[model samples]
Structure formats: C-alpha cells, structure tokens
Target: MNINSSICNLKFGLFFHLLFLSCSNRDEVKGQIPNVLFIAIDDMLPVLGCYGNSTALTPNIDTLANQGILFMNAYCQVGLSNPSRASLMTGMRPDEIKVWTLKPHFREEKPNVVTLPQFYKEKGYATRAVGKIYHDGAYHQDPVSWSNPSVLSVTRDGRGHKYVLPENYMPKRSKATTTENANVQDTAYIDGKVCQAAIELLNQLTDSTFFLAVGFRRPHLPFSAPKKYWDLYEREMFKKELKNPRRPARAPDFAFHNSNELRGYEDIGELGVIREEKQLELLHGYFASVSYIDAQIGKLIAELKRLGRYDNTIIVLYSDNGFHLGDFGLWGKTTNYEASVNIPLIFCGKGIEQGAINRSMVELIDIYPTLIDLTHGEMKSSHDGISLLPILKGKSSKVKSYALSQIVRPYQDAINSRSPDSMGYSLRTEKYRYIEWRNTKNMSVFARELYRMDDALSEKENIASDIKNEALMNQFSDIVNRIRK
Candidate 1:
C-alpha cells in the first residue's frame, strides 16, 4: 500500500473502533458509502435504443438510460483498448501513462500510479473486478488494483472462450471464424459466464461496500453471440448502403488504417476491399453481439434488484472505445474519427438526476473523480480528469468545450512505442470534429481535418484548409497546440 492508502486505512480503523464501542455495526459507516458497479463493454458505439437508434435491440440498456444521466457526447482519451482502458482507469492521459499500445502493461510505465479501483480499495471498499476490466492479457492486468482476487476472463471465466461452435474454431487454420451463433445456453460463451460469475460475486459482497467491475466482452471483433440474439433482428436490416464509405477528402494517408485487426480471422485475410455481402454479415454479427450483451446486463441488474442493492449502488456503464462497422471502409477502432472515439456513457444510481440527457462533452478519464466525489471520499492523489459530480447533480449544463480523443498513426495492434511518425489530436465539439495531425519528430503540423458533423457522418469532407475557414483553422491549431502541451 502507498502512504495515502495507509493513512486512510488508519483513519478508517479508528472510526470503526469508535463505532463498535458505541454498539454500532460497521453497516452504519459502510451503508453510507454507495457500492459501485462499473460496467464496461468492449467495442460498443452510442447506437443504442436509448441513444435514439431504433435498430438496436437493447431494451435493458434503454431502461437503464431512463433511470440515469446519459451523456450524448462522451468519448475516450484514446481509441484503442490498452491505451484507452489505462487512461480511464488511472484518470490520466495516454501520454502521461505512456501506454499507447496493447503491450507493456500500464504498470510498466506508471508502476505505482493508483487506479480507480485502487482508489476505492484504499478507502475501505472491497474492489473486485469480473471479466475483461483491464486489457485482455494477464501481463496487462493489475492485481494490486483489487482488494481481493479478481475473477478475470483472461484466466478462464470469460475472456478466454471466444466461440461456441466447434466449426468456427479451426486449429488447422490457426484462427477462428469471424462470427458464430450457437443454440446453446448463454453460459456456453464468454460474456454469459462472465455475467454468471458477477452475479455470484454480488451474492458474496453483501457484507462489504464493494466496487464491482463487470466487464462484458461483446460487440467486439469475431462478433459471436447466442443464436437467439441473432434471431431478434433480420439480417437484411444490416444490408444498407452507406453515404460515405471512404476516407474523408483531403485527410492524410496516415490518418486511416488497413482494417488489419479484422483480417486476422480465417475468412478475411489481407483483403484490401471488403465485399459488400461480407460487410452485411459482419454488421449483423455486431448487432447480435450487442443484444446478447444487453441480455446479460438485464440479468445482472435483476440480480442487483433481487439482492436489494440496486438503489444503493452506483451503476456506471461505458465502452472503452467506439467501433467502426464498415464506416469509412474501416472495420475496427484505433482511429481519431468520431465513429471510433465518441462512445456511450451512462451514470445511474442514488443522488444522480434520473432520465436526464446531457449534450455536453465529457471524457472517460472523468469517471475516477466523479465516482470518488459521489461516494463522498477524499481524493488524495492528482489526476488529469475533473469530476462530473456537478453534472450528475444537474448543477451545470456543460463543463468542457470538447471531449478530446487522439490516435497515433501508422497504427498497429502492438504499437511501435518508439515515437510515432505522426499523431492526431481530435477535439470533438458540439457541431464539429477538428483534428491536427502533428509530425512526431519535430511536432510540426503535417495535416489537418475539420468535419461538420451536425447532421451527417464526418467522413464526407475535410474543411480544415477550406479558404472560407481560414480563421477557424487558425483557432483550431491554437487549441490543439495548447492541449498537446
């Protein structure tokens, strides 16, 4: 434990001792501190039933939105899993964490940096994580963040199992098929078993004030889900033509990737152009996976209500990054575009204004301080994010001008930790998404893009250098330079 954690524990012990002498159970102190149920979905965008998407079959998530504050314009600091998760969990920027890739865990960069869960655990909360909370690998997972042994999918609970159908998993091919649907129970796959374990953990956490992180791995790549979820929607629904199916005009070549993440599967292999028919199949799979995750969330919430902990627990649901399903001819995340950065963020619990939708922008980094402030705990350490507590209470309409999200170009799953060729700083504002691509070596402006995303997809045009917007381009440059420093 660090010095701050030691001091908090000392104070808690003294308070508990005095309460015990007065014949008061620990519940008096613990009950006042709300339990935290942090839910993380893998690669989900804001296209949910609550987010005004009629196509998605996310009734459970929609119901939760009816009882919470929904952030219509929330985003991640980084558009990749490792960097994004590390940034949000630590309340730090990707540059501060020095974790811009899928390898060399966050601890490798900031070893003793207290994570969000560690923050709660330091203040006498039983912080436990279930499923894919951190990243996928065991090396990237942090055990010190939890107060007890975490039920991680990386070990066997959920993250390891990918496919339900034997044919989908071909050892002869060295990779599984991209999508699958089995007529088996939900527990046959990863997310179902993860939810089952989380429900079981909830039963055991009755005595302690807990920060339980239930991470659902669905709507991700190789989009696998139960057959019933696939049956909920007609596959033809996903076979629609897109308005802008290519990269934005005037955008640099380095700004876009080869959609290589999806190519690792058996079917898609280094194919430069994805067939239209295959794109529909992938979209259908993605939607099915989302509904499957929603079902699991419904079950978990039912368990919370059954245990009578629903009202006292703060439920935070968010995705680490938004996904691109054939948008701009991209099939995955790791982009600074709005489709890959703008994500769904909902806060539902006691003291939160219910059914309120906020258009103001916020970052995932703010989750750390927001939760601490809600629980009335002392925040001893410094972090890059500010608390959204006031917004949660409806005291303010806006707190940030833009939710910043960035990406390093020449993108690769295992990032080239050595300074990249270029880095794009994207500022997502109310009506526009402004990007400034800087040369990494000398930090010189190499490219720029400004997309007016009020009524259409952002990839239609890049207006940064448009002659009419000369003054606006100069202002955007100054904003990027100030934030980059």
Candidate 2:
C-alpha cells in the first residue's frame, strides 16, 4: 500500500470513531431522561390517608405518598380550574397569561407560549394526555401539547333518571340530588375510561421517553361514584364539624359565596347553606368518590408496574385545586381561603427522595421548572415559580417564603348580590394569611383580612380591623401591593 493512501485511511477511521463516540454520548443522555407520569385530580382537597384524613380511603395515593415526597404546604396559584391549570401548565401566573376566568383560552392571550407537555415534546419526548388535563371543555384542550391527539371522556355521572326523580331530572344538571351512588362498575364512569386509555398507552409505549398525563375527574361536583364506594362509608360514620358556620369576622362579604356551584343542580333549589343532614350525605358521597378515584389511580400504577416502567418514571400526583366541602358556608372553590388553595402534591420515582414530607410553601407553577430541571430541558419562556429540585433532593427546605393565590369576582349583581365586582389577592406565609379585596374597576383596596396561622380559627377570624396587628398587616399589604403592580 502507498504511504499516502495509508495515512488518508487512518485519518478517515479516526474521524468515524470520534463521530460514533459523540453520537453514543448523546444517546446516553437521551436515555437517562426519565419518563414522567403526571396524575391530576380535580377539586381534590388535601384529604387523604397520607395527609392524615382517616375517613379518606385512598390506599393507592397513600402508597404513592409513602414512596415519595409529600408536599404538605403546596398550593395552587388560583382556586378555579381553568386559571389554576393554565398557570401550572404554562408555568406562568394568571396575570401573565391573562386567563383569570373560564371563558378565555390561555392561547388566545398568549398564542406562542409553550406549555409543560409541549416543552417536553420539544425536548424529543412523546407527550400524551388522557382525560381532563386541561379544563373539561373542548376549547380548553391544547392541540400543540401532544404528539398524538389528546383523548378525553365524558365527565357526566351518566346515571340519568336512575338516581334522580323523573320530574326533576335534568340529566347532568339535576339539583334535586347531588350525591349519586350508582350500582355499577367502575368502568361505567368517565374516570374509569381515562384509566383504561392510560393503561393502553402505557402498554403501547416503547423505545421512547414519554410524558403521559392522566387526569381524573372525580370528587369534584355532584359527588357521583359507584355504590360500592358509598358502601365503604356509613352515613352515621360521617361527622359534620362546622354546621352553619358564619362568615369570617371583619372579612369582606365578597370573600363568602352562596355555594353557587353546588346549587347549580336542578334538584338543588335556591342558594343557601346546605342543611346538616344533607351535608353528611354529601360528605359521604365526596369521600366515596375519592375512594373510587383512588381505585382508578391504583389501576394506573399497577399498569405502570406491570410494564416495568414504575422505577424509571417520575410520578407526580397533584390536584388542580382544593375544595371547600361546606367550609365557611361555602360548598365550592373560588376563594383565597386555605380550603380552596391548599392542594395535595406528591412526587415519586426516579431522582426524588422517598418518604420525605416537605412543609415549605410551594406553588403549582413550580411544577414546570421542577420538571425542566429534572430532565435538563431548556426553558424558552419566563416562569413565575422557582424550581423545587433542591427541595426534592433534600438540598434545601424552602424555595419561596410566601405562596400567593388570587381570585376575581366579575360584576355579577344578579348571581351574587353581596359579592360585587372585586379581586381577592391572598398571600400565605409560614405564620400568617393576608388577603386584600380590591375593586376590579378602579383597583382600589375594598377590604382586607389578616389571620395568624397559629390560631385554630385562622381563616374564621379576620384580624385586618384589629389595631394591635397594624404593623403586621402593613407588612403583608406591602408584599401584596408590590406583587400587584
């Protein structure tokens, strides 16, 4: 062989070897990115066995909590479904996205903003959503967020006249009865269908990293579940803690509502405080629905395990927002109160500490940055929430000292005569909850509420009018004002 030819061949061989090594390293990094299993529940409060709710029969969720870090102080940015979901998915606050109400789609305001799943999809991960990841409506679904088309099921109870009186029957909107204990299988409900779809996707996933979001719609409204779940709890076993509780002292009338969401059913008449006897039945149905959803979650987790994807998947289970369950004479969300904001957040699987309970304040928007940090994905847009990766790894105890939540009450004089057009901005620190109700039109402070966290009736007592806590109230007001601008 000629010496020149041999030299050229050696150089070509060395170049190919270097190229192979670079490609191999890239593949290794891609393989190391763990799969994400995001489970979202609607209108779920922090009432679970792991969260110390003895009445909550959530063995699957409790098991997940035991195997993960249960965030004790995690809260939603807003209490409403569309606003809260949009905030977390976009990693932006409601103000930034301009999505404070259910009417406006987030994309309509920020058309180019990338969502959490879309971000993962951009990072070469296959993203799919089954069930109620976004709001339950068709307009709420984002087509750009998934690799394939998103799958959604009917959210109605589907019992029809079987559970309600024929005269008062309105299919999905009968107010005559709120709780339906249908004698049917779990698959008869929408959540069950969601589970089945998720399981099918899990079985089909191979040779690719994925972001599978399974959102369960249960324990939300109407409190419908299988009769077996209701059979798990006795009506006598359900205890009513606060019957006909008065509005918070010194709290603005705008802070309380007539449980309008609960009264939407045809069977339910005019808006009023639910009677104690009926409250027990509703509570039983809520718990029963929770248990039913827990069973569905168990099925999903079992499928992941069966597919050998449990260990390598990053499992995140959280709720969209908290529910009132008749707190403060309110039966729905949309207030800045703890019952509406505090949600259950659990992180399990790869790259997370197990059995760790974090009490530090965290927001739902933080989920976006946390997942980005975990997968080493790049962020193309700004985010209001800080990453909780340090807290998840036990490197830090707290990310932010305060978590903020807000709600806007539109001009609805006919619907809610007492709650005029106002905006409720609440800030929660480790020791206090400060709320400011501002006029929506003029942006002037209408009323204020201050509650010490150490008090048993912190939310029940509004110390904004107390002269003794004037300094503390000023400090909180300053914080809220700074953020407001």
RMSD of each: 7.1, 4.5
Off by over 4 Å in 2: 1-31, 153-176, 240-244, 377-381, 410-420
1-485 in candidate 2: lDDT tens per residue?
Answer: 99999999999999999999988987686567799999999999998999988778899999999998999889998888888999999988887787776766789878999899998898898999999899866777899999999887224434431243344345654355677777778876777778998999998785678999999888887687888999998888777444346667777776777777888766566756567788888889889989999999999999888887788889999999998887677888888889899999999988788899999889898899998888775555577778999988889998888888988875243233323466788999888898887886787987788887755523767877889888887888888776542
TM-score of each: 0.91, 0.89
Residue pairs that clash (backbone atoms under 3 angstroms), model 1: none
- Candidate 1 lDDT, 294-340, residue by residue in tens: 99999999999999899899999999999888788888899998889
For each candidate in the order shown, give its overall lDDT on alpha carbons. Answer: 0.84, 0.82
Clashes of 1: 0
Q: What's model 2's overall lDDT?
A: 0.82
The most accurate candidate by TM-score is: 1
Clashes of 2: 9
